[model samples]
Target: MKLVVLGAAESGVGAAILAQKEGYEVFVSDMGSIKPRYKAMLDAHHIAWEEGHHTEANILSADEVVKSPGIPETAPMVAKLIAQGTPILSEIEFAGRYTDARMICITGSNGKTTTTSLIYHIMRKAGIDAGLAGNIGHSLALQVAEAPHSTYVIELSSFQLDNMYKFRANVAVLLNITPDHLDRYDFKMQNYVDAKMRILQNQTADDTFVYWKEDEHVPNELPKYSDPSAKCGFTDEAQPGSAGYAANGTFVVNAPVHFEMPLSQLSLPGRHNLRNSLAAAIACLAAGVSPEVVRQGLSDFPGVEHRLEKAGTVNGIHFVNDSKATNVDACYCALESMTTPVVLILGGKDKGNDYAEIMPFVKQKCRALVYMGADNSKLHANFDATGLPTADTHSMRECMEHAVALAQPGDTVLLSPCCASFDLFKNMEDRGEQFKAWVKQYGEAK
Candidate 1:
């Protein structure tokens, strides 16, 4: 079999290596320059590859193509492949073919990383030899090739789900559906929603489907056919039949196993995290993890980086890096968690953000707004009317400097952009690292 992999980065290179290991003739192509590590990996494997351009002859000859999620359908080469009816697969789908690992796949506009990490922690604590993959940790294909495990907790984005066909999750977790990446979905909310729903594909009676009961879109879009898999819902309120919820300062689970714990015992912050905790607990329980183990794991899980991570405290002021909050809903989650007055660092590549959703939090919690992005006009226009103090800058350094100036004792300087990081940084991780670096220096100076 001939396999051509697109975008020679993490997922693409992983796919190539797996294909080679599976005895397929493999090739990797990236329109952009391949990272040195990935380039070396391809060379070490003796796989044929091209960088800076897609060789049509080499790519078109493939029996199957595995594409990185970042490569959209609109790319002319991909369109040609589609037109020719050549099979196109996501790395997730391709990887699933070779793994007997039971999959716990989590997908949503928000809270996916937290939920994925929490579930992985619980499984590990319960003595399950589970691997983490998909949008986090190592690529699933790479893990299947080398260090395979009995189970996997994967973080699936809508883009990754779009190309996944027959892959089934033993436990599917849908946190919530919100308007995000609408541009990639052709500006249609339903398109984005449909992409998220693909997580439930191929689920069976023995499988379990976990979702947010309160999300406006989730309940409406669920299949109308007589239910097969155990359908469980998580919410802030523990309804009569909910799989998980919070009630009376307790985290409660009623499905797979009955479990309860003091809500105050959860290590993560905010009401959103409470929902995340509920989802993770229910998924872990459905996977046969004991309630006691689940409770312990939830209590001990440290938290994911760049998602409301604590940088440091200087003379009482706190610095938080929530660089992963790349959309309005995510930003709302960060702001909602803030107890102290916030000097908010906001702005990035705006993804058609509706600032109105966060206006209430801004009014109540935000003392000053520091904007950082190539374009801040939209941010300025939307937020200026609210009468909040705002500053505009083009770099993280300036953003942090403004934050330090605006913040007082007992205040928080938060880096929750509510927008994509492409404008001024390579990605969210880079943005977060710069924030942490500058914040460390800023704190030491005080």
Candidate 2:
């Protein structure tokens, strides 16, 4: 069997190794440059690969292709493969074929990371064996091939969910869906929502589907036919006759195993995170993890690095690295979570962002705006109507410098760009790391 691995990054490389180990003839092809480390691995494992181009002959000859989640199905090569009747699968799907571990998959627009991490933390605290993979770190295929665990908590993006067919999560979570990655989804909200709903595909009546009851997307667009025998809903706004909801400064999960936690004690900030934690707790409960473990995990889980991370303070101004705020809705969560006045750094490759959603918060909490990106004209057009003070910076350093000068002692300089970071930095992680390094020298906050 010939397995062609598309792309040569983490997921691709991992898939290549796993396919080769599975006694298949694996060839990794990347249209972009493959990192030296991954290239070295290919050579070390004696696995064949080609970088800088995807050779049509080699790719077309494969029996199956393992695609990176970042590669959209619309890519010409992918379209051609589909036309030729070649089965294309995501790294997660390809990996799922080798693992017997029960997958606990989580997906959503805004809070999937928080929820995934929260569930993993809860499992560890509860003394259950679990491994984290998928959209976050090590490729699931690689993990399952090398060090298999009994339970896997995987973060599923819409792209990953798209190529997945029989890879069902024993307990699936959909935090909430919103308008995001519309360009990839044909600018249709339903398209993206439907892709996210695929996390529950192939799930049996014995499985549990966890979702948010109050999200407009859930009660409206959610497919009832995809119902697992059990349903658990998490909400901060809904009345909880059963399941979970937030009330009186606490999140209450009522059911087979009663759970409640003070809102203030949650390690993660923001109402979105509160809802995310609630959803994760419900998932853990459904998985049969104990309440004590859930409580400990909710209280002590270290938040994801790039999502609303506190970089440092200089001249009494705090810098927050929210490089993960890649959409308007994610940015809304960052702005709404601010306690101190914010000097928000915003701009990037606009993914058809509708800035109107965050205009109210920008006008109220934002003391100043530092627009970072080459094409910040869209922000200007949308923000001009808001009358918020705005200035432009072509680079991240300039944005940070101007932000420091403009910020007061008790204010925050938030690098919460409401778009993808490719325009300025290599990726969100690179952007976030640069923010952290620069803030280390700033002598403002302890």
Candidate 3:
């Protein structure tokens, strides 16, 4: 069989190697320049790969294709594959066929990384042989091809779910769905919601589904995708059907076994994090992790970087890097968690975001606003009428200066841009690192 892997990054390279190991004639292609590290991996594997261009003849001849989640279906090459009815699969799907590991999969608009990490930590603490994969760590294909484990914890994105067909999760977790990446879904909420619901597909009666019972979109869409016989668990306040819940400042899990832990002992803060913890606890419990292991893991786990991460304090002012809050709902959660008055830095590539979703939190918590992006016109259009002091900036350095000026002692300067970072940085990580760098530089000068 001839297999062509699209986009020679982590997932693509991993897919190529896996296909080669599986005895398929494999080729890798990326329209963008492949990173040096990925290029080295492909070379070491003796795999054929092309970068900065896609050879249409070679790609169109594939018996199957594994596409990187980052490449949209709207890409010309992907469209051609669809038109020709070629089988297209995500690396996760391709990797799944090679391993029988117990899969613990997580997806949502926010809190997925933290929840996925928390579950993995608990599983490890309980001495389960586990590998972390999907969107958070090493690609699943690479791990399956090189170092397979007894179980795998995966953090999936909507894009990856779109291409997955036969993959099944033994323990599936859908944290909460919100309006994120709507641009990729053609600005339709249902299309994005449908993509998220794919996590529950191909489940059996023995499989488990964990979800946020209170999410606006989850409840409405649950019946459409969830298997009737699959065991369903929900995160909510302790109730008749709740699998995990928080009540009286205590986190509780009832299914698989009864368990409880003090909410105050959880390492991550904020109401949103409380939900994340609940979801993670449910997933761990469903995976048969013991209560003692879950409790210790929840308390000892350090928070995810670039998601409400403390940069540093400068001249009595606090700086928070929330570069992962790349959508309006994520910024809303960050704002909802702020106790101190905030100078909220927001702006980037707008993804058809309705800023109105966060206006209430902005009015309640923010003292000022800083717009940082190649274009801030949409931000201004939405926020200029808020009657708050605002500054427009095109660079991180300028953004920090304005935020510092706007903030006072005891104030917090938060970088929770409610839009994608592509306009000004390589990605969310670059945006966050730059924010931390500027904060450190300013602190030293102070």
Candidate 4:
């Protein structure tokens, strides 16, 4: 069958490779430049690909299309495909059809990366043959094509879940659903919620669906998408019918296997992490990992980068890089975990964000605020009333200067910009790296 792949990045390139391996005629098209590394992969496979433009004639003739999660349905090419009644599948969906691996999928607006990594770490420690894929690791399609594992621990985003129809997760984890990516969903909360609920699609009684029991949205949507028999829930406090819970300063997992560990033993800190730990432990246990292994994994698993990562200390001031906090809810978690007074950095491409969600934390925990973005008007309008010391900066250098000036010796300068970094940087990782670099340079000069 003729298979066309759109957006020649990780997911798109990986999908093209897998489709070629499956003996389908594969073509990759990107409206933007393909990275040199990806170009080489396509060349090595002798696959036909075009960069910087898409040929409609070539794309229109395809029997099926694998679209990058980054591309929205609003894109002209995608809309054309829809208009033509062509099947467009995500890389995750296409890869799922080729692999018999037991899928352990994790999704949420926050903590999904940490939970996905933690689950992978635990599965590896327990000597289970597993591959890390989806949002955090190598593309699932690439892994399925190159090195298929007996099991796969995937960190899924709502974008990846949107096009997935027949993919089934043997163990599914929904961390939490909050107001995020509303722009892609026409600024509708239920539309975003419905996309997240897609992770539970194709799940059966034999499949396990693990989720945050306390999420404001998940409980209301659970009955609409999944069976009660497949439900496994984790929460901060023990409740009736909970699969995992925390009590008396210990994390507990009941189903799949009885397990408990002191909350203090968890490597990742904060109340949010306690819930993350609960979810990971439950997922690992449900996958048949031993209780002892899960405990050790939880205690030793390293935290995710750019999510509450410490950049460095400069002149007795600490800097944290939480660039992954592109939404208000994530920034709320970062602020909630801060013990030191924070000179909070906030601003970027606004995603129709409601700063009110984090207003309480900002008023309580922040000593000062730094607005860094192409536009800081929204931030100012929301926070200027707080009357805390504030600075407006369009660049990272200026942001660092203002942040350092506002911070005292013991204060923490956190780069948890509660918005997308595209206004000033390539992506969140670039924003975080630049923040760390500035912190390192400042420390050296001091």
Q: lDDT of candidate 3 vs native?
A: 0.91
lDDT of 3 by residue, 1-446 (tens): 99999999889999999999999999999999999999999999999999899999999999999998989889999999999999999999999999999999999999999899999988989999999999889989999999999999999999999999999999899989989899999999999999999998898888888888888988888766648535556665777888778899888888767888888999988888988888888788888888888899999999899999999998999999999999998999999989999999999999989998899988889999999999999999999899999999999989988999999999999999999999899999999999999999888887
TM-score, structure 3 vs. true: 0.98
Two-way TM-score contest, 1 vs 4, winner: 4
lDDT of 2 by residue, 1-446 (tens): 99999999888888989999999999999999989999998899999999888899999999999998888888989989999999999999888889888889999898898789889989988888899998886778878878889999999899988898878789998988888888898888888888987877888887888888888777676566656547777668547454787788887888546978888888887788888988888899889988888888899999998999988766677889999999999999999999999999999888878888998999899888889998999988888676666788988678888888778999999988989888878998888898888788555333
Candidate 4, which ten residues in sequence have the lowest lDDT sum? 222-231
| Model 1 lDDT-worst window of ten | 220-229
Query: Which consecutive 10 residues in model 3 have the weakest lDDT in total?
Result: 225-234
Off by over 4 Å in 3: none
Q: Score each candidate by Cα lDDT.
A: 0.91, 0.86, 0.91, 0.92
Ranking by TM-score: 4, 3, 1, 2
* lDDT assessment of candidate 2: 0.86
- Candidate 1 backbone clash number: 0
Q: How accurate is candidate 1 locally (lDDT)?
A: 0.91
**Candidate 1: tens digits of C-alpha lDDT, residues 267-347:** 987899998998998899899888889989999999999999999998788999999998999999999888899999889
